[model samples]
Target: MEPLARRTLLRSGLLVAATAVAGPALLTGCGSGEESPARSDGKPRRGGTLRAAFTGAGAGETLNHFVGGTALDMVRARALHATLGDLDPSAPDGVRYGVLETIEVNGELSAYTLRLRRGLTFSDGSALTARDVLWSLRSPAEDPASLPVYKNPAATFDFAGARVENDHTLVLPTLAPVADGRLLLCQGNYLVVKENSDFSPEVATSGPFRLEEFVPGEGCALVRNEEFTHPELSDAPYLDGLELRSLPDSEARAAALTGGQVDFAHDLSPVTARTLGEDERFTLTSTSPPYVSGLFFRMNLAHEPFRDNRVRTAFKLAADREAMVESVFFGDATVGNDLLSPGFPDYADEIEQRPFDPDRARRLLREAGAEGMRVTLTTGPETPGMVEVATLYVENLVAVGVDATLEELPAGQLFADYPAYTRLPLAASFSVPTPALPLYQMSYGGQNPAALGWDRPDVDELVATARGTSGEESARAGLAAQRALWEEGNTIAPVFKPFTTAHVPGISGVAEDLFEQFPGFSRATLS
Candidate 1:
């Protein structure tokens, strides 16, 4: 089975995998039963310097992960930009206020009344009000980069709009009773930025940290927000200042951590993590994030080999999932059958995974009359993990008699042609949130790789239906249908959920959630 000819595969299609993995209702039951801050034995102590390193040396734009979409940048964003509430990775749907004080969920769950914390203020002393929430939600929704990602959700106030009942209370109206709306609010996209605020280095916020400095694609420094309040975050963030430096490379970040140039590092590979974890001078905190890592099969029905379903199935069967996970992921990942991660509430447990059987793969290819095919895999230079994953894929495809080549480009260049890029029977890299909402929006939503033309009425209907309903049963049914659509179409191949391994030293509080979306920095205390 030769890989789909580069020209044949490049011929095109587009499909996006935009759904989030698990809803709060489903996750609450599966998460680790960790007690909240009030119950924790550790006490927060203010003030010290906390410098952290990213696998990449730094970030590209404002400390806005939503626009930039880098996990490293997100850590800083979480601290400077608080979400409407905090998504407790430990609790399935538990969303508590990071800046706001409390939220009253009505009996029907269709409406909510959010109360601002009494003395909450932006870093500049501007009082936080409903106006900020409204602006933050609306501004990004209107941003060009965000439209492709943030879709209309009945549960989130994203489209429905919020009404200010008073200075302290906000009337949040929703299309449906979103049991997990609070969790969605904690995502990188939905963060509550200040009203009329542009995320810039000079700006400041109400979170425990305030951005003191930022050098795009380089590093950032955050100092404590003296006005921060919250008993849960008491004495918190022992660090007087936190320096977020992005190294731009895993090797450099690891070296910095080991050499003591940096106190902490994020997104370290399994090998680097293991090495650092063994060192007594440092402590490792790792979480099985709700992110999915996988091979994206370009869905251009217009393309040659891809147009033949048999060819797609053959490649899917030929690739070795377990080997890739074990070899590339360092045995620290779970096999993905499709876009949905097990952590998501909408995940289909019944979906069968095609094992790594080259013979069967060959048979499928032969049956499809695919005598010889070739394809080019497109990925980014900064995607360290993808490079390794692509290498394994190439090796496996070659073993199964498929001819494949790897094309690595800069991160910016890859994303520019993301849609048409995948059409090349190419394997690309992506990590999305656990929710069906975010996942669906990025994959199959309007911006997906179905670059040529994609109009899956059935898929759209399922997603639309899910988006419309608020109840668990309806959501389950819609998600089931959506999952079926993904499986039936072979839009993208599931790979593994990578664990975020962090190395910390002289830090008393460094807890991580499975979502790996936000770092609980408010409670972090430097020893």
Candidate 2:
């Protein structure tokens, strides 16, 4: 398995662009009477404090985004640091520029040259330079050797050959040719921090805002970074400041927005989002397929039953995906076909969608000599509909003659011990739809200590070949790798949930990013 060091980049701007073109028609079925902020005739009125809420926060939150895991951590990280680029959801292939003025990839795709925009500076009055960028890129992989306290996963880039061409330009060499080098660098966690600086809030940041205060498990406050500049977005830091609060419960998050306690809220339940969408006071936004939310069942390949591919196939065949969507998700999601969701680049749609065949599952179980296999499926309220999805899965398993029991962990307790979560014989988890290559690398490729054991040298070679090639050849190789996962992967993704967010009528630019799980408030303005 190849090491996947890619970051999760949210192409929030894609939603904004869609709303701009579709106008009120986008919200026609959901509701009417309220004009979209993105479509409003009046120019954006800046200079106000925007408060937002997200689901789930813990004391473990840290300024070091490389190690941060929660939605709040990502929100704060985006406020404090900027990445090399961001995905453009509006584009057919989802491509966009972020901090980098230009990224030039060689014909073979093994080498990349990043040219930073002129006059870039951090919040602490430090000039942004190639060394800071280099440190940010290399430290995640090299820091464990230099500092034992650092344990975050390193990216798979070949940093040994990195070169600083000038104060504002740097060259990055990949171990193999990479067709999506720009996409890899723009991951949500790949923000740039000052070189040799301790990982603290006081450290200079290159994002649109600087951290003012952060109380783990609670929330944080941010102030505009006066010195920040980017080549893509003309208006930087529209809000005077931002106040982010963590409201883990879906109902609570929706209430916060409705009661005027917060200007924006994320991760609302489908029922709540529908209610809000019908009201004229708020605007609702959603993205599907490649960018949708997903519920997955990970079977530890090291455990009994799962170690047998027949048993795994049995479980996959038995999944009632459409039933789960209608019951658990309230008809707010699309059915997944075991690989990456549709509508994304390089998704393997040709792979046949496994049917909900209980008889076939039973036969497979019998063939594997696992009749009456009683296994415990652990799950938690990690996301909005996770617990419901887990319960539904247990029912499906039992229907196929498997005595599946449910062990529901507390809201955030499932991930308290990272190793424990991965070692569970069977568990329910959730993820947002990300790019195929990065998602495969992060969750399945290499010796991902936290991933369900499903690895093969041939698959790794396929991925490497896919990353090294360009054009149709690249797409063909990538699709082949994904097809392999669909057939033999250890995880079963049955549904792609919508990424739902709600904001007040006056707010614009909140849909500019997917990372924060809300709007990019830096570009947002209150009318």
Candidate 3:
């Protein structure tokens, strides 16, 4: 099958400005403080250091993002490496190109042609080429030591058929027809690195900022990448530099933001978000639904009690989602059905919402011949409010004749080892707003190595068909696949917590990226 012409694809201008699209709900203030000046004039004021705080800092941090899983690692990687594309908050299913000028897939959707923008160069003056793109997409999946989170997606591509047609054009053939091939290339860990180069802070980077210094588990400083070619991001170095710090504690992050220690803070507790929302000096932004950032748990089907569908359904019904939201989230989130949040492109909203019925939960357990089931709910302080949510969930489970106890691990321990979280019978987790297909592909897809025992070949086929087609056909197939998940998936998401971040009024142009743990600081500036 012939790929679409480059001219036709470029004419579509799929590579629109990240901020031009619909973004998270921004809560701006009308105040007259030096820190919160009126921005009636919509112009970027370039030149100042932007300090940001995020959770997850550890000795495990590395320049090799394929091996790094922390939020701090992602933020640092964003400043150092560039991906072929990224997810736009406004267009949940859309792909925004980065280094690539255009990507056109063959009619069958089995092959994709990627064209690099002209004259692209890395921070160290190395030319960015199609070979780099091929390597970035292939290495992670093929390397046995790469992080499983990234390895899973890379394993789906047919790298053996990849061909570099020219210095700027690369053909990426998939193992099978895929509808979201472009999005797969844009996964955060798939960032392009120079071909054949060792992973190091000194390696040439093609992103908006170059790594200046990195101290694992501490923080790093970044300087603007003078070679950055993205017009919207490189018109000028918005901030002269960026200083990212690791603040895992919610109270500490809030204090850092309010104490003027940092200009931006991410993953604050709902109570802190509400308090800061009232302060005219800070701007609070949040994303809900299809972009859910909330408490959830994945049940391992390999376990005896969870092996039965009835038992899994019982756990879902046992969760008091509304109570968890009101008590743990301080009424800052929406209740989630068993499926993905509503408004996401593939979300099956018509699916009936599972009510919090403890009696029904007990009946289901009894019918499954598993009455008085005892299980340990493993969780951690990985995100703010997770422990509290887990505790509440345990109480709910216990109320329904299930002997559920809580085992809280240290921060970052849950995901420290790949598939470690999945090994547990039941574990608490959280997810940021991501498109339904990609989320399912990474977590529940048949090929996923870390799948929590929820494997359905029919649902897999539906997802494949959805990705291979476009427009109405694509939406219909995608929805059908999501419907299957809603009916039988093991993950129990009761609330869609907002992805909250607080920034000083002086900061602007922080793009709401659904893929990244933190907002894109590439285009951020300070007045």
Candidate 4:
């Protein structure tokens, strides 16, 4: 299929095969139990600097990533510090342990134990122990220096009751029964640091790479910890050095890759992914499902017409999910089922798919006395897919006799003011990949502002039940809550698109790391 014309996005309405051009079908699961395709030239090459281009690597960049607001910030954090772990459903305990070996939770889910791997050391030659972990987790909340990502560790876990039994062991006590404590603790925010030590770039960190040089808004250089070795992180620090360059523009990121200035481009637009993927010189990889962002639209209950369930149902029914995935993403994404987390254990995949039925939608609107209702869909390029998806959805709404128009906002301004954002009758947004229950609790459940007044006490109880238990009991309650939300929720989530990266042929480790969104070169190589 011919590639969609550059940036025009709406030329002949031809849907191209996005993945067909996304290099070879290597089937990399991006750390959810799939191997990255090996470099064609056999054994892994030993040492060279690997350059990567990503946006938000600007002047505001900080080495302390507790409040990382950009992709590059988190990228640097993962590179410079060893993390607790990452949420990986494929793992037996739903996590991939990093510096710490295991997180054992008791039956009631209130008590927990953290066991660190023995013999871990920092770049400054300090022995990494449980005391370091205790300080790092508590000090953030005490001084209140951390950001939104740091909230869970501070708020959920009871640090006051946490005690260190020995150098390698820390026992934690939680305020309540929590089944997914491991996920919360190991979600990359928790790190180890010396007691009472400020997180200075000078201190020995948890990662295998040491910072060599840093210049805000431009880039930074990192040197490998020559003695660093990780049992699970594949051949880490294999490269002698790494360079990160900041290029905020998608076009510029792609240009850098094609121009030989950068060996890898992070988070390209689907259009660029398809274009570069078609080139034989580069290999395209995406983070796996349940890890990708799920695009959604929330119809505020406080808004006119939406107060009527039929109108909300009609608006959802009007969307043509398949066409949006094809035309907007060029078939790079999967169609959402008016719900998020398509493949998660808690996701209600067995539920019937929502269908596109303009006829039914029109009848429902007429029944609700909402025929010819005028609603402005507030959209922006929050992600490459948001505006395009809104455009197509509005067209579908118009087909059902609703006067729907797209109101595009400048990038970064969409959620800059939360009040104005949530006040819109129709808001278009997308959520980064997160576990099912916590994601809803954080964004869509209860009276959360992002929920847009979706208040359902029963659903909340179901979720609470699900979150407090495990195995079959949790699944049953979680599915019950999700099924209710799927049938009547105010949000219209229609597709989940992966975070994509494209690299030159010699790039071998981009898709193997557990943190697939911002890949690390600890295992990457140059030709």
State every prediction's TM-score relative to the real structure.
Answer: 0.79, 0.86, 0.88, 0.80
Model 1 C-alpha lDDT per residue in residues 386-498, reported as the tens digit of each score:
66776777777677667777787754345543344545555465555556654554456553443334446567656656655667765675667666555556555546645
- Which 10 consecutive positions of candidate 1 have the poorest summed lDDT? 12-21
Q: What global local distance difference test value does model 4 have?
A: 0.73
Candidate 2, clashing residue pairs?
Answer: 1-446, 2-446, 5-155, 12-513, 510-519
Q: What's model 2's overall lDDT?
A: 0.71
RMSD (Cα, Å) of candidate 4? 8.6
lDDT of candidates 1 onward, in order: 0.58, 0.71, 0.73, 0.73
lDDT of 3: 0.73
Best-to-worst ranking by TM-score: 3, 2, 4, 1
Those runs of model 4 whose alpha carbons end farther than 4 Å from true positions after fitting are 1-43, 57-66, 127-149, 153-156, 188-204, 215-217, 226-229, 233-235, 300-308, 363-382, 401-426, 445-452
lDDT string, candidate 2, 1-527, tens digits? 11121000011222232333344322323221233244256556657777777754456556676554556666777778777666676654355565677778888776888888888888878788888888887786664322111122234466778899898988888777777766666655566788986878578888889877666555667778888885556666778888777555666666656655566777777777877778787888877666676778888888878888899899999899999999877888888777764666667777787899989999999999998898899987666778888888899999999989999976556665666676889978777556777666666667565466776778877877777776888778888888777778788888878778888767777667555343455577776
Q: Tell me the tens digit of each residue's lDDT in model 3 across 1-527.
A: 01233223222221121121233322232321255333467767766678787776456666787766666777777777876777654444466777887788888877888999888899989899999988887778777656666765555577788899998999888878887876666654467789976887678998888877666665677778889887345475566788777666666666666655567888777877887888878788876555556578888888988888899999999999989989988888888886654666567676678899999999999999888888999988777788888899899999988888999877666777765666899977777555677667776777465667888889988887887777888888888887777667788888777778887776777754335355667677677
Clashes of each: 48, 5, 3, 6
RMSD of 2: 8.6
lDDT winner, 2 or 3: 3
